[model samples]
Target: MKKVLAGLGAALLLFVVGLAVYVASRQHLKFSVPLPAVAAATDPAVVERGRYVVRNLASCPICHGDPKQMERAQAGEEVPLSGGFEFNIPPGKFYPSNITPDPETGIGRFSDGEIARAALRRGA
Candidate 1:
């Protein structure tokens, strides 16, 4: 019984230490990016081009898109992006961020610089 208790205690200590080290390493890996002065373009042509890129090239519409509209988008028809797609993968379950103009649930709350950096993944 004494030997078993000692072994269990040692294992618990090792797990705690390992978890701390993993957390510390992740914190060190975080990098800060300077926000740029640019804002999302408002030109109609640029807007349409961005939509085209997201729908076709990057295929973001197939993932970070409205669930109800996914069928249309998948069928090669352009659908409005209202990001709320979800998936589970390593680390955790995740949902694509809302990109619509809604102030409460979308990019409307974020500054232009933040949006630009996030979109370009400046630090990531």
Candidate 2:
């Protein structure tokens, strides 16, 4: 019984130490961005096509919240694309950002290439 208890205690200690190391290592992770390839479209047709892709094909509004606002967007009535969705998980509470063109709370500060990269690839 004594030997079994000692082994269990050692195993528990090892687990705790391993967990601590894993959490600490997460703080030092480096993010790398790739070079931009394509520029954002300026033509009205291209913009409309992108909007159609987002609303009808991609189902962005499903995750974005507000069916009525989504409907307005679907009708092409220039609705705000500000995202404020929250996803609760074991690691942390994940809040999706407001993606509107508003400079303060959205992706307005990001360049067109930056937006394209972020939309097309992970960790951009």
Whole-model alpha-carbon lDDT for candidate 2: 0.75
Q: Model 2, 1-124: lDDT tens per residue? A: 9999999999999999999999998987887777577778899999999989987788666565444576776676655667756778878987656787778988888887788777766644
Give the range of the ten consecutive residues with the poorest summed lDDT in model 2: 59-68
Off by over 4 Å in 2: 65-78
Clashes in predicted model 2: 1
- Best-fitting candidate, scored by TM-score: 2
Candidate 1, lDDT over the whole model: 0.79
Which one wins on lDDT?
1
Please identify model 1 stretches exceeding 4 Å from their true place.
Answer: 1-31
